[model samples]
Target: MEKIHYRGFWRSLNQAWRGLHYVWKTEGHMQFHAFAGVLVLAGAWWFRLARWEWLLLFYAIGSVFLSEVLNTAVELVVDLVQPNFHPLAGMAKDVAAGAVLVTVIQAVIIGIGLFWLPMWRWIGG
Candidate 1:
């Protein structure tokens, strides 16, 4: 195989493009999420949420995308190695999915904590 030159830069760009495509298309939940994330940021900016709140939002988005990419990698590796149905391979995929789920849940909790009360007050609820 020919060696890739400027591989670090190329690799970063490739990964970024893949992630953009993945978030934009492949992940069903991710589309809604990206939208919601945008809305949250807009609200935060409008409301002038604290720096820590913005930090938490950044972490939330990072966690979801990172977990998703890791999960995709796990699934791909499992398929490449097994190439057929196998209990262990299934377990590997399940575990990866679980990791994404865990991140999503944590992000949701943090999001609620960060946004919900302020939203409630804004609505006078």
Candidate 2:
């Protein structure tokens, strides 16, 4: 195999942005996650989360986003390789989806833990 010349850092960054744009445009789940992530960050600001709380919240958000992007990539690859209905391809897609679901659930748990008490107190008070 021939060695490929390295592109500049800016070109690599541009490619990454293109991938993110593709996901945002093509994946409804990604759109939903982006909206929800914005809301969560806004809530963290509104609630004035502590340093550690902010760290945890950001970590959870990043985890879910990363999972979603990877899942989308997996689905796209599976579709490309096996456009026809095949059991193994279906299983691969399902597993990728499941990974997204698990990450979303964990993020929800983290959000609830971070916000519930503060919200309750704010509402009650």
Against the reference, the lDDT scores of all candidates come to 0.85, 0.92
Q: Each prediction's TM-score against the native? A: 0.80, 0.89
lDDT of 1 by residue, 11-121 (tens): 999988987786567677667767777987898898889999999999998888788878887887899999999999999999999998999899889988998878898
Superposing all C-alpha atoms, what RMSD in Å does each candidate have to the true structure? Answer: 4.3, 3.5
Instruction: Show model 1 residue runs off by greater than 4 Å.
Output: 1-8, 15-24
**Model 2, span 1-125: residue lDDT tens:** 97765677678989999998998899998888889999999999999999999999889988988998999899999999999999999999999999999999999999999999999999995
Specify the highest-lDDT model's number.
2
Worst 10 residues of 1 by lDDT: 22-31
